[model samples]
Target: MLSPNLLAWSVELFIKEPGSNKTVFWHQDITYWGMGETDDEVTAWIALSDVSVKAGCMRFIPGSHKGGIVDHEDTFSADNLLSRGQEIGGIDESQAVHSPLKPGEMSLHHGRCFHASGANRSDDRRIGLAIRYVTPEVCDQAPGRDWAMPLRGEAPAGGWSCIAGPRGLFHAADLALYDSIIEGQTATLAAGAEQDVSMYGGTKA
Candidate 1:
């Protein structure tokens, strides 16, 4: 059974505009996350708008997580949504399972699951909020500091910096804090990458 007590590692709001060619290539969430092969993390992808197959809903490979982390190629394609366009080659597409969700509905997947989303062909935007949760035991192995916000039960004792809730909507202090977190995390995500990480724009020396 999954634990009810969890900390929010991160929350990302994805908006794929109508008729957008942006494609999320076949990849695993575990890549470049520095968590190793731990199973303590889960991603709750909540659909803010109707996410249909035509709207580029995410697809998963059944039992792919059992293979653990494998080699990934960084293509850095212009239409790819990933930071590095990291992809796992030789995936049998015929075995993929598409996951479509209605507004307010959510789908959960392990961090190691191989997943990808296609281009949005629908007329409406495909919006979703993905919240990554991790148990207290999960710790970052990448460089620099890491953090998680405690959402339920006792907070973690160490290894992660516990972030506080935002003070106000678009507050200056809160915005600054948000920028700091992104800047710090960019380094960890871009570690060992070939081309400079374009996530923050401008090349990193």
Candidate 2:
């Protein structure tokens, strides 16, 4: 659920294979997002499979959203699922709250919440869908421009342009648009850097 002024910004599926060691590092969603100034964004993480601590369920630092953005370091580990393997510093793991959920269940968190997931140690795979919602008042701050779909209310003008929904999977026009968008996103995420540090707007660790 989102404010009336907000729209669906993006959606992504994250999967952790059974017995995989890949992990999502501790970091705030806003840090990697282009959403500017206003942290008027929320993420709905919907579980597609039975998820638990052993299956790498998400963990959050309660009330951590109020602290604002903090410093992060790129671990560059092969098992890190983050774009840059970015991890927030000085975290007290003892304060973390593990969030386990059944299929179809979901958890909502502010964009600035500190969160992460451990390596999956279960016998079954774990899948989660993360849907991000952002208010039109938020500005895109990444290198390349960004686009968002209007899910509710009138779509905002400027900053992001409107895009038509794909009529079918792998449609020619859709594929072209997808390629163009991916190019822009890759450039924006790369930020002209040669390594994973490019994703971080601050000094590399």
- Runs in model 2 deviating more than 4 A are 142-144, 192-205
- Weakest 10 consecutive residues, lDDT, candidate 1? 196-205
lDDT of 1 by residue, 95-201 (tens): 99999999999999987899999988999989888898998888788423887898898788876788889898899998987787777677777889988765532
Worst ten in a row by lDDT for model 2: 196-205
Highest lDDT against the true fold, candidate: 1
The candidate maximizing TM-score is 1
Estimate, for each residue in 36-59, the C-alpha lDDT of model 2 and write its tens digit: 436678889999999999999999
TM-score (C-alpha) between model 2 and the true structure: 0.89
Q: After aligning candidate 1 to the native by TM-score, how far in Å is the CA of 146 from where it should be? A: 0.6
